[model samples]
Target: MVVTVGLARLCRSVGRTASSLSVPHQAAAAGLPARTRFISTTPASNLQFKLDERTAHSSLDLFKKNTGIIYRMLGLDPSHVQNNPERFRDWAVVLGDERISGGRHYWEVTVKKSQEFRLGVADAQMSRHDCVGTCNTSWVFGYAQRKWFAMTNNKMVPVTLVGRPERVGLLLDYDAGLLSLVDIEKRQIAHAVKAQFKAPLCPAFGLWDGELLTHSGLEEPEGLK
Candidate 1:
């Protein structure tokens, strides 16, 4: 289900400002203050993609390969896992089964408040030693040091948004070469990065300590079937 209830409430300022606006004639008569208006509209819910277990580096494996990270199975479904830690550290993982060469695909990730994380897609051959956005093999949107950034070639470009989102959506258009990272709670697109894909891309995740990162399973959206 779409996580809208809490988000709508968090973004009430946008709605309030939109409602307070007056038409041209009314503004002219009342001598009211008028300014350019911007309100965030909720986008359609489209998160749907299965998490591949075979492709994943489990908690124990992740810890073994990288001492700073931890992973755990959150629910009964083994495919659904979570990043569990009380503090922040560097870590990343890729889904084993799902690989997209072309067409449109999307997935949603739920993060705890005040947590640091990165979500994106990467080349199938991406290594555990490689950090997302530091190389051409991966593209990721991240929140850290109280700033939003898009990573490419290990470079960080600042991304400014009105507020923080608890749930972020990743929309991939492989054929069109578009990768959009969206704020699900605010219902706004945060950033859209484009790259020519020469290799198969798979879902990639990274997390540090401070909060949980749950892998919500995918379901086919209507009409896509």
Candidate 2:
């Protein structure tokens, strides 16, 4: 999808804020090496494949913003904001204005060691009050309270992997019924799940702190070109 909104128009859309971008939380396993005990069937991590920022569009209209889930962006650098300290309270914003169906798509998200952020895709009808990964409409890989999780149907499934990933890549295959998360730094697959999607999916994010979630506009590497 082509997103033509200029910087000025985008600011009006999200009601630009003065809050400084927050740093990622320091995780307990912050410095450990990335380790995945389960083997992956996909190609070795493709560090070069990132969502093209030029193709990114703010799906702000698709989100429910009345609940204090703030959205801000300077050019393509978009971040979710929530300044006050509140437990179990999370805010999310989706990327790309259009819904995706029946194809392979990937994006790399860089996050701090904080144990409270989520990266994944959610059905367009996902509940605004439901934190990503805590409901059936979403499939998210997240970290909370020093543990890694892949939540679906409001159930927390612990993902056993050594250390933490600074840059994680998400790959969605609609037809294949697969959602995969890769540890980009380690060139390894962190986790994968199979699901029969019922509706169009959007790239969604969840954050509890002021942590910045940069949409690294990476494309297939030169060799693929």
Candidate 3:
């Protein structure tokens, strides 16, 4: 199901003053007062995509390599499994069902429950065996051990945040070749990067523990605009 929500509220102000006033005695002659008008409008809706149903056997099979991971209706969780050496060792990456080629798209992920999780986008055909952000096809912002970071092409950069964020936002502008990670409650950008994306992309995730819930079909946050 797609949930429609407005993430931005914009207000603009227009002002008009008698320009003649600055032209010497024209101010007294015009006898006009300065006026200001404020306008408020609802944010426009952005492109939205749906997450593939977890109940689908085919969908679950796509991540078979990611053992010990359980897919739920709205989220995914990792269950400790015995004798599973690969359990949470390799990246448990999941891709959204939608394929985005162009235009700007925005979404949010709830990471409060996951102590270690990855959020970002990956090329649709990227190897499932490769971890998100570790390969050239994906870019991701992650949180672990009370620290946050962004990674791509095996390179990781530490990002400083004011505090831990419960909900994180992702904005992908295909035309601009930009990907930004936002801290929802703080209305601030946690990290962002620019790239020459070459392939159709999908929202991707890597969950090592706990669970992650995603929110799509959201308007871009005003601060980022």
Candidate lDDT values, in order: 0.49, 0.47, 0.56
Q: Which pairs clash (backbone N, Cα, C closer than 3 Å) in model 1?
A: 55-96, 87-209, 88-209, 89-209, 133-154, 134-154
Using Cα atoms with residue i matched to residue i, what is each candidate's TM-score against the true structure?
A: 0.57, 0.56, 0.64
- Root-mean-square deviation per candidate: 17.7, 16.3, 20.1
lDDT of 1 by residue, 1-225 (tens): 101112211111111111111011111001212223221212332333444443344441332222223444331243344532211122335442355666666667665644456678876665444555555677777777666666655555566752574767676777767777756655556667767777676667665433434343343233221
Candidate 3 has an lDDT of 0.56
User: What lDDT is reached at residue 42 by model 3?
Assistant: 26
Candidate 3's C-alpha runs over 4 A off are 1-45, 53-90
Which residue pairs clash in candidate 2?
25-114
Per-residue alpha-carbon lDDT of candidate 3 for residues 15-74, written as tens digits (9 for 90 to 100): 222111100011100122211321122235465544433311221223323322343333
Least lDDT summed over 10 consecutive residues: which range in candidate 2? 20-29
> What are the per-residue Cα lDDT tens digits for candidate 2 across 1-225?
112123221111222221111111122102222222221224443222222222222322112222112233332223443322211122344433335555666676666544466677776555444555555667777666666666555544566662565667777766767677766655556667667776676666665433434443344222210
- Of the two candidates 1 and 3, the one with more favorable lDDT, higher being better, is 3
